[model samples]
Target: MPALKLLKLPPPVTEEWEWQMNASCRDIDGSLFFHPDNERGEAREGRVAAAKRICEGCPVRRECLRYALESGERYGIWGGTTEEERRATRARRRVR
Candidate 1:
């Protein structure tokens, strides 16, 4: 009989993720970030503001924003920034 060899995979690289573990918005309603069918005007503003307020005190705000921007998130509030805000940020980054 021939001997069989087993293949092994390397462990994934990890960093300190305690910030995400302690995010303030972790328990909040996700609907607050993605509201009624791309709503606009004062109501949208209020919802975004509410979401941002939660993000403001979040320890993982930077990580969240980096993730959203890198992943090209086209909806909802992340890291205290709205879709339009992220769009502008992307444009600015491109210009630089």
Candidate 2:
């Protein structure tokens, strides 16, 4: 997986509080930067869920997930999708 370093931008200097559930950004081409898990699937899931709580307060979640899937990222949580889900999707695709 690649690295998405843009997600850590000082909370959007311009947007401030504009980031919502539908917000989207390039986020350094959407890579592994957003990954919070160091290999523990359960721990990562918990972290993603915790992050979702933050997204509930965010305005750019939708866009984030969209960018993630679009960029073929099989990493941390994005657009509400988990690494396992992405892996399953890839596995299914391979089966086809």
The most accurate candidate by TM-score is 1
lDDT of each: 0.86, 0.58
In candidate 1, what are the lDDT values of residues 2-45, reduced to their tens digit?
99988998775456445566778888778998979758799988
CA lDDT, candidate 1, residue 80: 86
lDDT of 2 by residue, 39-62 (tens): 467765566666555545446676
lDDT of 1: 0.86
Q: Pick the candidate with the highest lDDT.
A: 1
lDDT of candidate model 2 versus the reference: 0.58
Q: What TM-score should be assigned to candidate 2?
A: 0.44
